[model samples]
Target: MRSLLARLSLLLVAALVAGCGADASSAEFNGVRLEQPYGVPDVPLTDTSGASYSLKEDREDALTIVFFGYTHCPDYCPLVMGSLSAAMNHLSEEDRERVNVTFVTTDPARDDEQALRDYLDGYGSEFVGLTGDLERVVELAEPLHIYVADGAELPSGGRDLGGHTTATLAIGEEDEAVALWKQDTSALEYAEDIHALLADD
Candidate 1:
């Protein structure tokens, strides 16, 4: 699984390196800027391993990479996850240990514990996977300017194609919601921002 994801990451990285992303923001943090440091709520969620997850407590002083999407997502979800995995791999062991990569499901109905684990393991075992009520997830995204519009189900009985915030949010020291990269940002770009944010602290 790791090999497959690595290959995918390499391929995507090649294409994405030239373009920042569809909504790429090349600001100070190499991500779209937020007007202020938005306070993330203490939203409750269940991790893939059945562990409790509290956003407020978990990210209090950690440089966290937060992504809002579902496991079944065909394009943005896997691409972003693979990119993030590769970015982390590019980091030194010490720097990698200081960072937290988290994924919150926007379509909880289908992303159960096992499903979340299976998908996340393909990227990085250390990657945190959280799934819970869809409405609650949406509530959490609203403050971050993320919108998850529901997509219609396909006639072929394939899983519903849901749309979500494709941005990979970075919450750095003191738990302040800081930078974010869009779908077009490359893995290298993400790795750079992670290093930059850590240095700013």
Candidate 2:
């Protein structure tokens, strides 16, 4: 009887552990609802080359990924963009052609047309960098819930500012945000999510 009781207790503990693991895996963003999703809207903005391109103009049948950060960001910006580039590398050539990635500079003061162009050029030619009028930048960021505030000053006596979140906005074929992947996620996972989205009818 004691042996049977011990076996039952072990089963209960295993079930509890499995339940906890599932909860952690599916954890949602704090204070951010998954229900009322907001995507990057179609707006006119100047790319790094000073050429104007609408969000609608850049989008295609596949998923579009958008990141918001400044050139001056020391760590997070580069890391996130690197992960995105890695994710793109994992894609097949046909899939690569479908996906479009845009880097939007929240710190327009330091990231003017020329600066923005130079920064993203190192990453990949396919990666487009965009910066423009401050008011227009805010208008584009508000819907995605991206928060940009002025940061500390640099040693060069220049005022340096940065954005808060490391969120990637994933837009579907309809030009609406279908999913938001956070910083903790891996490039492989992001690529998988994009593949799933593309496969869907």
Candidate 3:
């Protein structure tokens, strides 16, 4: 897992650097600009409100930020969520309204609707949480190239809820992923990229 993360981090860094000098036709972003945009996953999952949510059909805003991680994650998940929460705080009310964030749990056994809701409320009420059968979750993540795997028991007796890709997908107005943000991206960067995307729209 450590090695996998290292490789993924390197790839993310390369992508970020590659996007630094985007052409006038493209919106300059702090995130890695995808050469080929990814369409929103067509799968439906159970939201915190126990309602079925489809990323492809039920997006509430023009831009949707989607991430897949479990609340039990020891490092990456909390850090990313905190950064995103801070980023949202930095946005103007209008820009905030143009963006929506959704967190889909890769560890479904422990992340029921209420649990997902409780965990996400700490980040932002507007942040949506979703969970379902692990197989279904994998189905939702596969198309995006978001990794998910079975966990292993930790040395401390706590279980590590497997491994998952830490990159966040920024789905644009056309239901396609226009950019990717690495796990360690700063809140200020997130806000800047979001504002730029909104401006382009």
Q: Which stretches of model 3 miss by more than 4 angstroms? A: 1-28, 150-164
**Per-model TM against the reference:** 0.77, 0.76, 0.80
lDDT of candidate 1 at residue 11, scale 0 to 100: 89
Best-to-worst TM-score order: 3, 1, 2
Stretches of candidate 1 off by over 4 Å are: 1-29, 149-164
Scanning candidate 1 in windows of ten residues, the lowest lDDT window is: 152-161
| Poorest 10 consecutive residues by lDDT, candidate 3 | 153-162
- Count backbone clashes in candidate 2: 1
Residues 1-201 of candidate 2: C-alpha lDDT, one tens digit per residue: 999999999999999999999786655322122465576566778887788866666655477788887788887788878878888888888788888789888777778888877788777777888887666766777777765434454453333434446688877666677677776567787777666666663
Per-residue lDDT, model 1, residue 83, is 92
RMSD in Å for all candidates: 13.4, 4.5, 10.8
**Tens-digit per-residue lDDT, 1-201, candidate 1:** 999999999989977875765435444456765668777777778888897887777653359899887777888888889999999988877778789789887778888889989989999998888887766776777776667544454343222435544777888766668877888788887888888878776
Candidate 1 has a TM-score of 0.77
Which model scores highest in TM-score? 3
Off by over 4 Å in 2: 1-34, 149-163
